[model samples]
Target chain A: MEFTSETTANGVSELSFTVDDIPGVLWSPADATGNHPLVLLAHGGGQHKRAPGLVARAHRYVTACGFAVAAIDAPGHGDRPRTEQDEQFTAGIRARLSAGEPIGPQVATHNAALAAKAVPEWQATLDALQKAGHAGGPVGFWGLSLGTGIGVPLAAAEPRITAAVLGLAAAETLAEAAARVTVPVEFLLQWDDELVPRDSCLALFDAFASPEKTLHANPGRHLGVPAFELASSERFFTRHLGEGVTQPR
Target chain B: MEFTSETTANGVSELSFTVDDIPGVLWSPADATGNHPLVLLAHGGGQHKRAPGLVARAHRYVTACGFAVAAIDAPGHGDRPRTEQDEQFTAGIRARLSAGEPIGPQVATHNAALAAKAVPEWQATLDALQKAGHAGGPVGFWGLSLGTGIGVPLAAAEPRITAAVLGLAAAETLAEAAARVTVPVEFLLQWDDELVPRDSCLALFDAFASPEKTLHANPGRHLGVPAFELASSERFFTRHLGEGVTQPR
Candidate 1:
């Protein structure tokens, strides 16, 4: 199914779009009228729509707030075509690295090309949202983990996005990304989290360019955030997306 | 190759322990004196020691502050024995869940048992530390992600641990774990992180059994704790470990 439409408990309209050409899904509230701000939500590595609790919650918030939400599944994940060959390729690269062999320039270039191949699809989705009349003045993006890696470049490449929330991601360091981002952003950090180091995030945050930025730390493990803070996320999205656009019913 | 030791530039001892009987490496800092406190550091799922920068930083902090640190690699990761069969098993389980197929009770039980198997080994590690002539008074724990998962039970089972710093973990629902944790605890939260919900963390904090609880929020993503707060971690270990240890050189 390329897209599906449904109604929420509050009698609002909702849509879930599945890109046949890609391996991901996009969701939006039906009540998001023309010129409504669009929020594109990105998932973490090795996860799909259901992995992060925040996505669903964010959906609910944006829906109530009159903003459209789009949740995307990255390449090699979800319903996207994946093969043992791709896995083997990654494995081979990993093996070489583990054996203390430097990656040949060809291998690195091939990987980069593959990554570049996925960008247009993501950008196309953003364009589609704008064309659908759901995008307000500028788009907003929220990415986690690998999503952050992709989102950073996307945001930088497309000036159409006016604001972003890059949680656990950076272009160089958290500080560098922070400095590069001209939009309002909120960075989240875990004090004792072991998956992503504290230093990386701090360095990124230090590099943020916006004075409107803020850093929030909460207790919970990696892959455990959505279950930890549903209300706060609602508040954050609502604040950024605008008033009365999202409110818990 | 069972264990390797190095003195850091700052004069702290970095030690890695390998147990042939187990699948992973256990890294820590050699105690300055035999009488220093001991802390067990656990990592989250699908991550090695380097993934969570806080683990090593915490180890360094505790060691510099005159405590011993032990970091363990969990099952299915970090120099652990893993085979295609194990990957298949994990994939099968995930596939079944994704397809909405009912999981057999046997499979569930088997998986649960595998997780439970680590408990004794963790306990025995503490015992080994004690036998090594380290001062056993006021043992503590620090964990993020999977580490948080294991630390909860470990803290409950091991009465010797006096304090803990838990980031990005839910012992149970925040409500259940908070009620159960009788010791002083500090929780870290990232407000916009998607992997774990922020609400759950807040709920857990509210449920703490002791009054000596603190919540610190920072900005970043699901990658474990942020980097800028190494000093805070040092202070935390120092306050709990008791005085007389020197700060990092």
Candidate 2:
């Protein structure tokens, strides 16, 4: 683990780092000393680790809860180099769009493939972060869309994750993985999502084995989740990961 | 409206009053002076104005947000006398339960009758409260189950209500009324509800005309709403009715 850059603004410290060539950034209170609850944020498809929404959310979590927020680029996203597989997947989506065919199946297939590689990278990063004493407390996962595609499997396989806020992905490829996730979950769904069928999203929510899972569905297209949800998510993390909380529900 | 009793405890003032023959209670900050946003609390079937859940929520709103909360007994509920119609409805429900029959249709029919009488009483109560200067700001409505039955019609007919937290009923009797409601809504659904069919609840949510409606579904039976929802409702009102808020969403 190595930090390549560090800056402070608005009482938040931003540190850019790498773990085995995977580029990522961490945000925390500028004057922080002891370990804080850490949240791993995964970006949507075609978006990088530093996407505007991710940055804004990171800032809110840090300033409001004094928590550490981190994000890393996916296999072919951000400043990372794209392999031939990534190129082929993009072409497939474009071809489906031109033909007016639903692209969900192809997208799910590619996401599953990407998760195979990305999950190990995420695990290595978390191990490195823990070793460096930056993150060792209760952990949380926040991801939607392609992020959910990757997050379902990651949370299922990662025992360190205590809670997750995930959604906007279908159930076809993720239900089995979702069934393995027993931690508390907050699932988001777009009622009129263009890319994913509403039933599929609801089905995925149904598959979660977590007894404390809650589903928040709003009327919008895929990218149009209401703004109030961000505040809701902050409160969720506070409830599960704040001071004196040591058990996973 | 005439005040019949008043008491103060834990920084909250509880005042009992009546509009015509209908009895109700008002809760507000003990030191409250001048107008504040008011939230109308509707009790579920077989419950009263001062039900345990209602009182707890009222105290929280008053102390946490400085908001005034009020609750009124349904026509044949709380301290009010049960008429012949109420007696027959109760008998019918008891019979259905004994025979192992679904009572939703009968319950909806009875609720519709109760709502017809309760709406006018509520309007009169709101008018009297506003005339007395206790409630003159943005108004919010919170109710579920039997409360939702009455609230669907009340919010549709009353123009002062700006936001509502409603659910736990079906679309069989409330779909048309829900379509006329344009205020922001936070709808709750219990996933494993024994009384209300899940599909019916989903359909009722779909009928809301409000552009900013959100559905929060959790795993539970009819009376098993999780504790976290109360805090979430407080935030919903804060967003739509607190401070410098005059317009209904």
Candidate 3:
């Protein structure tokens, strides 16, 4: 994997790289003199590395909390070309949604496959950033929907991450993932999410082995996640990754 | 893959082979002087090739319908070694079932992966059997639950299979698979299945593109699948596969 780094005039640098052809972006405080805390951001399903939600969250964590944020497009999303499996999945989703059929099972099936592919990509990216001296401090995580589906499992397997924000998904295939994760977590749930079952979502949260966790359930649909939740997540990160000096003098 | 063949006292020749280290059993009527129809059977999750349901069904097909039947242990069953993914899947199932949580999502996730692995194995077995002269006639399929999950997709992808029996499972990830299947189908649904949602099962049955298909829904639990359903499946296979002169005398 190779990265192209660009520093903007506003003291923020954007680094683009590919791991096993998975496109990813990393945002960092360009003016930082040394290593900084890293927050690996995972985007929801059907989204990309630079998704607006992730971009806004990344920037907030960088400028507000002094962290380097990284995100990669999940398989078959963003700039990556669609494979045969992706086409099958997209066609199935479209057809099922049109018929008003339940899509939860199909999503879990595909997400499990994507999660297997994504976890190592995040690990590889973290390794690359550490070697470049741009990251390698306390690591935290934030993800929603598809992001949560993939991020929870990835974070569970990786010990570097100490905190997480997971939202908007159920535990069908994620129970095992949540059980393995012992990191502090702030889990958000959209109570009226049409595509996700409330009981399943709560079960995933309940399965978390984390010693410290808080559940934030808001009254909204899947897309109607309240914007205020972002602030709540930022504060969670601040308390975890921002307590120490992000950079050594 | 190596094979050990034994001609039993009942005049049934059993060929046990390992494909990619996956164990399988082939049952053929030794009295048949020539080629006969071949039916591939897939057992459910956590069950192996020697599963009582699959074995009894295979024997009836061989003796009653004179069809050569074959079944293989799914990736983690029988003699095949359990992979790390398989271990994760087993742990997930155990945790969910123990907690009284829905195992559907976990089932779909692991089945999808196992399905992906099992499909090529079936094709490979067919290719090997054809070369060995033990198979290569009208091809049909039979599987329920985990079997249906893997069998439906396998039958859909293999045009040589002229008929299939799939049921006792949901349509979550099977819509695309059922769409690709145009062969005759005998779908069996066990009503009141504690684990599989009924709506999802019917939806899958409705998604089948096959012009010749029958849905037989019985009132019973998942494990309480009526013993008579086997008789119904037998008639369906016989109607589809028994009419042709499967042997070249």
Candidate 4:
């Protein structure tokens, strides 16, 4: 499937890209001009681009901050149609798990393979943006929750990504893809957060090879953070993206 | 329903409280002695006592650390049976939004009403723990993600709760609850966390009226925090529980 862009009356351009060669939407600012910094926003597990609060917020911030943003729904989410092949793959895993068979390693391997296959689709979207005359040098990849699982690997694989932001996520192992991110990386974590263990997050941070990294801790729970901290994110992005804005202390 | 208790081989007793007024599970540890503090663990949205990762970690910590722990699944999550009444309460709001109707105030009012109704169920669990001799006087609450939403309000409503550890949660306005919490409150936040905005968490911390609060920042995302920071939680709980155990820095 080919990618396309449509301009909405609200001055937002909805760019459609392919996932496993299937169509998906990527919302961007239509009014953006010059060599604006680019951001590719990825949603988390069981969520579409619109469902993940961070993706929507990133779109708003990047657009408002004079940068172009492309928010994509992953292969199984949003407008991307699921094929019978995908269903069979998942069903096979479920069947194995239900039969009292140990499927953990198999599932992990399958996910890694799937992630590897999905990289070309992500790179294609970036190439499309470059072809659209919005090539703003290296793009910034922002991943939320499950998106982090995919984004970390993709960013490491694609050196075209200059910087990356990971929210509410941790590298499952210290030796995994997150440690491989050589570009400037920023990690955000919640302290009393029970959803993800804090030890895993700290371990991932300690494992990162990136010299340009910062960790910020604030007070709020999973969904509560973004609903409450738009300004802080705006400031963080501004500083990191070199937009020259700082939030008050 | 009545509450029940059974002693396990590991010298830890499991106390279960059945709520006839609501469908919920109250799991508490019955091993409180010599100033060993109690921890009340609350799970996130659409979750129950046995939710993977977070709940499991809480149980491990409570058992290993010699702290009494009480955990309850909220109204719509876990073993609790969902009712048509509950369905309508949330479905109505979604329907309204889907129909392009403005229902902001109505949703807020409904949430407030539902929270008011739900508070008693949690209070009942607390009362049952006290009655069963599972909880010590200086009880602390640890809420993960959506659990933090419930914990913040519960801590404010119940004066018996001596301390609180809220992970990844914040209200649009933090003053009312922050002012009401008389005990030490710890707010944990993540930087670059796409799950929750960091500013909202900071606002929540700033809103606290009590001076006995600490904020810890770590590297990682929402799920990453809990996955990585179990040790930090133990340290925080121990510091506030004050049972004289030296924590690992």
Question: What are the chain A TM-scores of the candidates, in order?
Answer: 0.74, 0.96, 0.94, 0.75
For each candidate, what is the lDDT? 0.58, 0.91, 0.79, 0.61
Query: Which clashing pairs does model 2 show?
Result: none
Candidate 2's C-alpha lDDT? Answer: 0.91
The per-residue C-alpha lDDT of model 1 at residue A88 equals 72
- The best candidate by TM-score is 2
Docking class of 1: incorrect
TM-score of 1: 0.44
Decide which is better by lDDT, 2 or 4: 2
Where model 1 places Cα greater than 4 Å from the true spot, the runs are: A1-12, A18-20, A23-26, A30-32, A50-55, A83-86, A89-119, A170-178, A226-228, A244-249, B1-249
- Per prediction, fnat is 0.21, 1.00, 0.00, 0.25
Q: List runs of model 3 lying over 4 Å from the truth.
A: A1-249, B243-249
On a 0 to 100 scale, what is the lDDT of residue B217 in model 2? 99
Candidate 4 CAPRI-style tier? incorrect
Ranking by DockQ: 2, 4, 1, 3
What lDDT score is found at residue A22 in candidate 4? 48
Question: For residues A114-170, could you state the per-residue lDDT of candidate 3 as single tens digits?
Answer: 888888888887777777775768888888888888888888888888999987788
Tens-place lDDT per residue, model 2, B1-249, is: 899999999888899999897899999888657568899999999999999999999989888877899999998899999999999999999999999998888888888889998888889999999998988789999999988998999999999999999999999999999999999999999999888999999999999999999999999999999999999998999999985222221
Model 2, residue A101: C-alpha shift (Å): 2.4
Clashing pairs in 3: none
